[model samples]
Every structure is written in C-alpha cells, then in structure tokens.
Target: MALDHSLVGVASDPVERTWRAGDVIVYALGVGAGAADPTEELAFTTENTAGVELRVLPTFAVLAAQARTGRRLGDFDPARLVHAEQAFELHAPLPVDGRVQVVSTVTGIADKGSGALVSTENTATDAETGKLLVTSRSGVFIRGEGGFGRSGPASDDWRLPERAPDEQVRYRTRPEQALLYRLSGDRNPLHSDPAFAARGGFDRPILHGLCTYGFTGRALLHALCSSDSGGSDPDRFDAMSGRFTKPVLPGQELVVSIWGDGDGAALFRTATDDGTVVIDRGRVRFH
Candidate 1:
C-alpha cells in the first residue's frame, strides 16, 4: 500500500459540481453557525429573509461544484487511508446559484518507511464565467502503504508551544450536525452511516473535518476577537491549515485552546470532552 511516487502530479478527471440555495444554508448550520446569536451572518436558515444578497458560504466550495471524476481512496484501500492535513484558499466568494467545475490533481506522493503521504490539489471555478472561486490542498497518510523500495523522508513531528494558552473557548455541536454538514456536498458515508463508520474503525457516524474547521473558526472568533464589527471582520479567516488526529462524533464538546505566539503569530488546538485531540499541530495567521 505504499505511495506510488509515479502518481505524483497525476491530474485526475475533472469533475463538475453545482449548488442550490438550500445546500448553502444547511452547510452553514452544520458548523455551529448562528449558535451564539441566531442573528450571525452564517445563520443562513433565517438570513435569507435579510435584505442583502445571499452568497454561498465560502467553505461550501469544499463540497459543492466538485468534479466527481477524481480517483477516490477506494481505488486503494479504505482502512489504510488517514487524513493527515488540509488547507484552503479563497479567490472570491461564490454566487449562491451557479454550476462550477473543479480540477483535482495528485500533486505529490511521498513514501516513508512506516507510511506514505499523498497530496492533492483541487481548483474550483465557475462553470459559466470560468471565475475561480477557491483552491484546496489536502494531504493524507496511508498507514499500511509504505516501506516501498524507496526511502522517502518521514512525516515531520510538530512542536507545540511550551507556554500555557491565554484563551480557550468551547463549542457544542448539534446532534445531527454531520447530516446537516453533509448536505453541503461531502456525501462521504463515513460521516452519515454508522455501519460505514464502524467498518472504518469508529463507533458511530463522525463529524466532517471541515465541520470541525468551522467550529474552530467559531471558537477563534470568540477567543481572538469580538463578534462585533469593530472587533474583527468575518472574512479575516481567509486561510486555515491543520492536521487531523482523531474523529469527532456529533454532539461532542470541542474545546479550542489558543496561545499567542507574539509578533502576530498564534497557535491553536481542538480537543473533545473525553480528552480526544481532534485537531493538533495547528497555527493560524491573520491579516
């Protein structure tokens, strides 16, 4: 199961994806949006009645408009696939209604003695106008797919901040959060069907990693800045990168721990109630 370095830079089949109004709203709620005030910008369920033109939530790019033709992990093996890291870049906010096309490619494949890392990049564009909406980069570790003839470098070990965090925020997820989040477009059954999860090594349906990302954003909003306009801009969180260490079940309490790294840098980590660290070796940079 080791990484096939030959697969590096292999561009997968382009997939076309589209989004509807309802899909946008459901995605917003899945990530704990509108939980604090019910009047927040992400309260898509009610904000539709607001005066402004509604735009699809940016994170929805991960799910919506994806070209379904890419090579999936099933082409390899499910039990060996481990989501190692992920990141996103927003070129522009997507219009609520539109068809989009995404081009996904396997950018890098590295083999270590113990495991392999596969990196993929996805670029989404408006199908009609060809406007670039977002680009995503993801890396996954295939646990048993290593020890090939080649001796690639191992995954780097991260060093967390030594100082105690200056702030911590806790957020609660809805019972059906995964179901709601999946509506955004990621229909990975692992997050929906208990049978699939148990087979994948979980007890029950698990939350989407991006859902965890959204919840972390909410916690960051609380820990780093005020919800008021004078405090910070909602769009400030333009980029986020993190490593996924564990699965997050629905209704779990995520306690986001943050430490100021001085000179504009900050560190973060998210853990569940049972002391499970869902996100680790995390860092956030702001404008």
Candidate 2:
C-alpha cells in the first residue's frame, strides 16, 4: 500500500504542560539523577539548608505536549506504531517551577510501501516568561498505516563519516533505573514490574525511552559541548538524532563513541559494556 498524500504534513493537536518543583525532581530521579550518590549535584530531593528552588532537568523536553486532540494511536493498529528517530535543540535553560506550552506539528511524512514515516515537531515555550525553551523533533514509523500515498519532500539521511571514533563516554545505570525514570510521569510498567517485563519478553525492568535519550544527550554534550563551559551554550553543538534499538537494563553501562567529521558534524553510537550496540547508527550535527 502507498501512503495517503492527503495526510502529509497534517498537524496534530497542541499539548500544554505546566511543571512544578516536585515534578522536576521526580523526572531527575527517574533518570538515575541521584543514583551516583545521595548527595550528587543533580539531586533535588535532599533536605536543603539553602532552600533554593529545584533545577529543571534538561531531559524534561521529552514530556512536552503534542497535538493529540483529534488523533488516537488506537485508530491505527497498535503494532504499526514505531518510534523512528528523535532530535532536540535547546534555546534557553528551563526552570523547575514554571508554566510551559508545547506546540507539535507534522513536519514530514514518508511512505515506505509497507510502512509510513510520520515526523512531528514539538516546540516548548515558557508560559510565564514567554521564552522559547526547547524544540524536539521526532519521527514514528507506522507499519500498516502507509499506502494512502502520503509523502512530502524527500528528506536527507544523516551521513556518518568513515573513520574511527575519537572519544567514547559511558554511563552506568542502577538496577532501579526504570523505577527512577518513571517519576517523570511515564510509568510504563514494562520498565518496572518483573511480571510486566516478562509479558513484554524482557528478562527484567527496562529503562525509560527518554532515559536513553538523556544518556545520548549527555554523551553528545561531553563529546561536543565545552564541558568546562557547563553545557549552557548551544552554539558549541549543532544537532543530534538516533533510533533506539534494544532496551537497556538499569544495571547496564552504556558506552557511547563519538567522532568529529569536521564542520561540527559528528557520529555517535551507544553500546553495552560487552560491546553490543544498543543505539546503532547515530549522527550528530555540530556547530
């Protein structure tokens, strides 16, 4: 079946979100924010003598609203929906306590005969200050949803250079990684309960999808951004995108390899400690 050209560039409903201090902390914990130490720098749950407001975790960009008002995934076969790729760009630092709004729009639609690629963009802005915070670009491949002849302009695939990686960064997860990441309000039991994981063909709880995204961002920041600059400057980094392959367990360490191909574009991969590639074929565009 061909994609339905009528559905190309179709925009979805806008999603609005407001975050509080507690919400910020929980999101951090879900990603193993304080797992390294009870007194880690990113820990927000600890009793504080300074009584400062909680700092927002950069990964919170994933939870921003999308236009789902008139759309329901169940309308299409559930198995047809697959996350293809995701990328995010940050413009300003986000605060823990603030009102935010997300406006998502369809950016691309490609028909791949048996499957369809639907690309969406989520733009987040601070409601109070009216500051543009972040923009998240995502694509989902729906296996059975194509054949309506829907496809827009041809998009370019990110190119990876043929060379060895210059730097590799790794992060280890605790057995309760999913438990911690779920505090961000993505309580999919597949990452927590053993029975649920078994039902999903997993040996144990898995990490949140966004946790992996966070790890990728952390790796990119380490590889591209000036670590000495504390990751606040977006000019140092260009862009990043990747697909999630195998689910990562909480206790696993993700080794990410990044290489500079000049012109600020780089390539990266996240693998397991045993050298199994978890996120294969990643590309980063740097400034």
Candidate 3:
C-alpha cells in the first residue's frame, strides 16, 4: 500500500486530555523512575512524598499525544507501521497535573523503493492557560509499502562531540519490565504474551520503545539533573531525541554514556551490558 502524499502538511483536530498527579506517577513507574532509589526519586513517583510537587518525565509527552497519531496519516494498515525515531522539545516543564490539548500534523512522508517513512509532529499546549508545553516529532517506517511519490522533508541532523563520553549511568531492567510498561497505554500482546511474541518471531516479549525512551531520560536526569550526583538541576532538561536501533529484552542491563556539548545539554547513547547499541544518535538539549 502507498501512503497518500496529499496528507502531508495536514493538521489534525486537537485532542484534549485531563491528566492528574496519579497518572503521572503511573507513567513514571512504568518507565522505572524510582528503581534506582525510591527515596532519591520520590519527587517523580509520588505527589508529595518529599513535600514537593511531582515532576513529569519529559518522555510522557509522547504518551499524552499518542491519541492524535491516528488522525493525520491516511489509511495505512496498522500492521505495517513501525516506529523509527522520536523527539520531544519542551518549552516549559510539564505541570504536575493539568488539562492538556494536543494537535498533530503530518509533517512529511518519504517514498522508499520497498517501503515508506511517515513523519509526524504533535504539539501540546496547556488547556487552561493556552501555553505551549511540548512539541513532539516522530517517524514511522512502514514495511513492504512505498511508492508514495514524495521525498519527505529534511530531518534534523546534529553532531555529537568527538571525544570520549564524560560519564556513564547503569541500571538493570526487571524481568517483568515490559509487563509493567505495557500498563502505560501500550497494551500490545506482543509485549505481554509469550505465545504471541513467539508467533511474531521472538523468543519472548520485548520492551516498549517508549519505555526505553523513558529509561534513557531517567538515566539522563540522574546523571545530569540530580543533586549530589552530577550536580545538575532537573529544570535544565529541555529536549531529547533518539533513534531506536535494536529491541531490548527485559532483564538486561542498560548503560548509557553521557557526553556534554559544553552547553547545558548533552548527547547520549545507550546499550546493553553486552555492547549491543539499543539507542543510537541520541541527543538531549537543555537550557
């Protein structure tokens, strides 16, 4: 099937969602927020466990905008869509809980000989105040589908530093990690049912890409935005982008290398302890 190139540049109707502090905590836990140390990360996993309002992880913007992904893209079979890359630019820190309005657009689509890449951008604003909160961009790789007759738009291409990583953060994923992550609105059986995973040509369930995205962000927050560790502030985190290179099996150890850009932000690359690069060409830009 070919994508409808005509749909490019079209914006979808806004989707309004009401999220609460409890919802934020669930998403935080789904991504392993407090696993490093519950007390140290209580601000993320609890509303006021530390007497401060919880801070939403930047990656949750993807989840908040997911409902609108179906609007702009034309009738491509859901079976063929595969997530390729994702990015989020935060204009302001996400409130602990509030009404959010999400409007998405099909920024572009690229035709490949065998398949097509569909790119989308979703912008979210605070519903009550009309303040822009986040703008998220993502690309989907459709297999066995192409011939859309368009080359899409130019994507952002930035350079990482040429030196060694400045720091590394390590974390271990639980065997039931995927199970917990799926509760965060991604209920695909491929992530929960072993029989379904085997049928799909995997030995067991795989971790959600967004789950890994959150984990990567959590690692960054710890290494660069925490007190007494990297001597960084959470408010400094402004944006993050990454390309998924490999699937992560639950129960594997993830080690992420943090390279500072000499700016407030940094570049990141994550891999399993076995040296398999799971997230590549990753970057986080903060002010």
Best by TM-score: 3
Give the TM-scores of the predictions, in the order they appear. 0.81, 0.76, 0.89
1-287 per-residue lDDT for model 1 (tens digits): 32446656767766777777776777777787777677555434443565644544445656653566635543555644667777776676566666778888878666665677777888888888888877888888776666665543555565777887888888888888888888666787878888878877788888888899878866665456443544334344455567898988898899998987665457889999777899887776554
Worst 10 residues of 3 by lDDT: 225-234
Error of 2 at 41 (Å): 3.2
Q: Per-residue CA lDDT of candidate 2, range 134-234, in tens?
A: 78888777676666575656546755557777998777887777777776676667677788767655677777667877767656764676535353333
| Candidate 2: regions farther than 4 A off | 1-8, 12-14, 37-40, 43-54, 65-70, 77-80, 143-157, 192-205, 226-239, 263-265, 281-287
Candidate 1 Cα misplacement greater than 4 A, ranges = 1-6, 41-43, 51-58, 70-74, 112-115, 128-131, 149-158, 221-232, 261-265
Q: How accurate locally, in lDDT, is each candidate?
A: 0.71, 0.66, 0.79
lDDT tens string, model 3, 78-147? 5455567899988887777778888888887788657788888988888889999888999888766776
Q: List the residue pairs that clash in candidate 1.
A: 1-145, 2-145, 15-67, 16-67, 17-65
TM-score of 1: 0.81
Cα-based lDDT at residue 164, candidate 3: 84
Candidate 1 — worst ten consecutive residues by lDDT sum? 225-234
Relative to the unseen true structure, what is the Cα RMSD of model 3?
2.6
| lDDT (Cα) of model 2 | 0.66
Quick one: ranking by TM-score, best first? 3, 1, 2
